[model samples]
Target: MKVQVNSIRAGNVIEYNGKLWVASKVQHISPGKGGAFVAIEAKALREGNKLQERFRSGETIERVHIDERECTYLFKDENGFTFMDKETFEQLVVGADVLDEDQSRWLQDGMEVTVSLYEGTPVGAELPKTVVLAVTEADAVVKGQTASSSYKPAIVEGGIRVMVPPHIGVGTRLVINTEEGTYMERAKD
Candidate 1:
């Protein structure tokens, strides 16, 4: 699919210079003297290479279409992460290079994830926008820190740290934005 360069966002797969790349970062700049352009930092899908490119607002870019399937997390072992297709009951083992550290940290047993397939091969895994995790450790509120709204650092189940409100404490289940690793609110349930 062809899309305006400025419309591209992070995590979008695009084809540039006859190579498949995933946009890791996209920034739109409009200088006072120069025209508007979209700056993109993309990583190669097949090979682990990074590339930066700029495109004018009027320019179009090719967006690669990927097949997404809902798969249930099975386990992770010497063979890498294993996921089972819910509908077909097929098992897929994806490598660590494709899953990455950040994505793998949040993989909980029995969790469902969206696997992106490019030409029938697994390329990436997408986690839920928001995940509920319990706060494993929370810093104690300081004496004067409670005067205004402030955030404190805390650790979650995945060993990832997140800044949560001061009122939150250990054992509290908090709603978090997985992409940004920020606390949203206390889990209702």
Candidate 2:
């Protein structure tokens, strides 16, 4: 599918020169004397090489079509990670390179994830936007510390470290923003 440059966004997969590329970043600009343009940073799917290119606002570009299927994580082994398609019960083994380190932290057995497939090959994985985790390690509140003072660094059950308010401690359940791996607030339930 051909789409205008202005419609591109990060995470979009496109084809150029007979190769596949994933857009890492995109910036739209409107110059004083010229039509608007878009600056894009893309990474090659085959070699992991990065490149920057610019395009006019309405320029047509090849957009790769990928199928997103819901899968449940099974486990990781020497063969990389394995997932099962929720609807078909078919299994897929994906390479470690396809899943980023940040996303790996939150992956657990039976966790639902969105797996992108291009021509029947796994291209990328998307985890939940947010997850609730239990704080496993945190500093004890100081004797005279107040709630408005400062936040303390804490490690969650999965070993991802984040900052939480002073009142929170080990064993407290908290909600986290997966995009930034940051603490949002105490978990209500």
TM-score to native of every candidate shown: 0.90, 0.84
**lDDT values, one for every candidate:** 0.88, 0.87
lDDT of 2 by residue, 65-144 (tens): 98989999999998888999999999998788777676788887898998889889887788888889999999988876
Model 2 CA lDDT for position 136: 95
TM-score of 1: 0.90
Q: Candidate 1, 183: how far from true, in Å? A: 0.9
Cα lDDT of model 2 overall?
A: 0.87
Worst lDDT 10-window in candidate 1: 94-103
In model 2, which runs have C-alpha deviations exceeding 4 angstroms? 25-41, 52-60, 143-149
Model 1, 1-189: lDDT tens digits are: 998887888777899999999787799999999799999998899997999998888899999999888999999998789999988999988888778887788889988998888898787888888889998999997878888888889999988899988888999999888777788889999
Error of 1 at 162 (Å): 1.0
Error of 1 at 49 (Å): 0.9
What is the total number of backbone clashes in candidate 1?
Answer: 0
Best by lDDT: 1
